[model samples]
Target: MPPHPRTTSPPRARRRLRRALACAVTISGVLLTTAGTGHADPYAAPFPAPSMTPSTLDARYATERRSIEQALRTAHGVGDTGRARTLGAFLRPGRRFLDFDPRGRGQAVEVIGDLASARRVALLVPGADTTLGSFDQRPGKPWSTPGGGARAVYTEASRITPRPGLAVVAWLGYAAPKTLSSDVLTDERAGQGAVALHRFVSGVHRVNPAARIGLLCHSYGSVVCGRAAGSATGGAAWRRVTDIALFGSPGTTAWSASALGAARVWAGRGGTDWMEDVPHVRIFGLGLGPDPVSGRFGARVFDAGPGGHSDYLAPGSPSLRNLTDIALGRPESVTRA
Candidate 1:
């Protein structure tokens, strides 16, 4: 018998195939159990649309505040204390929201600092499981919610030298997937989020034409930013985006930073983030693709320090400082990993 031709299965290919199958099984099982049970929010209602005019921002905020107050009254009338409590927080003095909606899972775009006069703006896109009720759950704990996280970054950036007036937007403009669900594994939600995010950024530019914008994307929010970066929908507004920072990201769907169409891309992952174990492979739109921090992805790697998935924005952390630096367009100050 003729000698059998030598055969080998590449390890990298095998690993990817195994991960693909695992993803398939996970998606199938989750779909079977979760079909038609998306848990729609019962308190959904439309509110006033935002005013993008820089001169009218305060008026728009005032309009939204009044709408929120009405929503709070409605929530109280409906006996939904949880929703009422969340809406009540928005009524507090000095809480400036660019956009507010009481609809499903809710949407809020809160500004921390003066947006009207800011020379630099950081838009903080949060990850999964963020909602109105959980907006400020842990209050001063910073990392506990998107709003608190943005505040922490603002606090850190305020301390930067040659203080360039910076504004931070806690943008919960899309419905994030539940952290425990299979939805987080794919970019479906991200695709929808990109459109909303793109519009929001465009509006921001319209309001402040001179300001430089930076995206501070966290976890699944990085996926949203990646999609927005590569999206062909926006105009010169995208050109105003100076930097994009992906932290604790599973993947950006793009193969590399250059592919994201971003001017500059920075990536980091905390030393102890559990997301490190997630497979970085894309198969038939099932996975999130290459890890952003990997050399292969070609992003500027930064030191995220020894923290968990949610600790990237923790007060006084290196990751927070690096994020502030990136937002302020001071890449020279960012600590490399």
Candidate 2:
């Protein structure tokens, strides 16, 4: 008796499977080439701890300014003209930073408005490849940097009718993955980033106890926020963060919003975002988990329009307006997708 067609394994089918596996392996190898190459910043210098009182905030900012000025000089002395140029911008008056360490890829925390008097505050956590050099000039993405994006959101918030006392923090407080490396495939960096983010939130609360905090996480930054919100150590700091918005996310490494421990969670993705094609599953400590924009995730999905991954905060875009609404604590005004 001949074997049943269903039970037979054809040579063509076997070859196809082998080809697919080979292609996946090659792609993985290409991405992992830059893994484990990250090094600590040798020029790092500690600044003052965050202040509790509004009166002392100016002093904190001054200390950071001095640190940046010194870093700029060092960069110039070393002939690192690119880094020197980026650092020089922050030395200008009216530019306020809570933290600035020009070491390794560098880290900074910038405030767009008066945080001390803010009734509503939004902290933006950026994604991978975010370094001091790319802070304002991220190749193809113009307004997607921590500083630029935060400023754009701040500008949008200012245009809101009956505007609230809103402030935006461009938080580049962690060593984000600098390339499409194996580091981004795991949660190691996210875990470290979560700790840093938690500490920053606590500091923000100390500065403005009355402020209601919201988190605006983009791309890989969403994973960092997710880990912080769902951490076992999440306590008073987590409580102060009333809302979280995840945009252009790969995944939250979580199944649903309840796991995030946030009161109100909102999610959105651009209509043309390439992240939609990323494999949404977690296994062997690899791959970001379920999609937050999916119905099963149980988050309020907003209309992001037909922008690409980096166009979410483009001036006058629907995503930017909706993000502004979220930052201003006006959920009623956010248009649903």
The C-alpha TM-scores of every prediction are: 0.87, 0.88
Query: Highest lDDT: which candidate?
Result: 1
| Candidate 2 per-residue lDDT over residues 81-189, each given as its tens digit | 9998888887777889998888777889999899998998899999988988877776655678999999889888877854668989999999998434677677788
Question: What TM-score quantifies how close candidate 1 is to the native fold?
Answer: 0.87
The 10 consecutive residues of candidate 2 with the worst lDDT sum are 1-10
Local accuracy of candidate 1 as per-residue lDDT tens digits, 1-337: 0111222443776656655754555466456544564755555465656558877787888877877887787789878898898888888888988887887678888999888789999999998888888776765465748888988888888777657699999999999887667788789999999999998888888898888999999989999999999874547788889999999898989998998874799999887675665688899987798999999999999999887787888988999999999999898999999
Per-candidate local distance difference test: 0.83, 0.82
Clashes (backbone N, CA, C under 3 Å), per candidate, total: 0, 1
Q: Which consecutive 10 residues in model 1 have the weakest lDDT in total? A: 1-10
Model 2 misplaced regions, further than 4 Å: 1-31, 35-44, 48-52, 139-141, 232-234
Residue 77 shift from truth in candidate 2, angstroms? 0.2
The per-residue C-alpha lDDT of model 2 at residue 18 equals 49
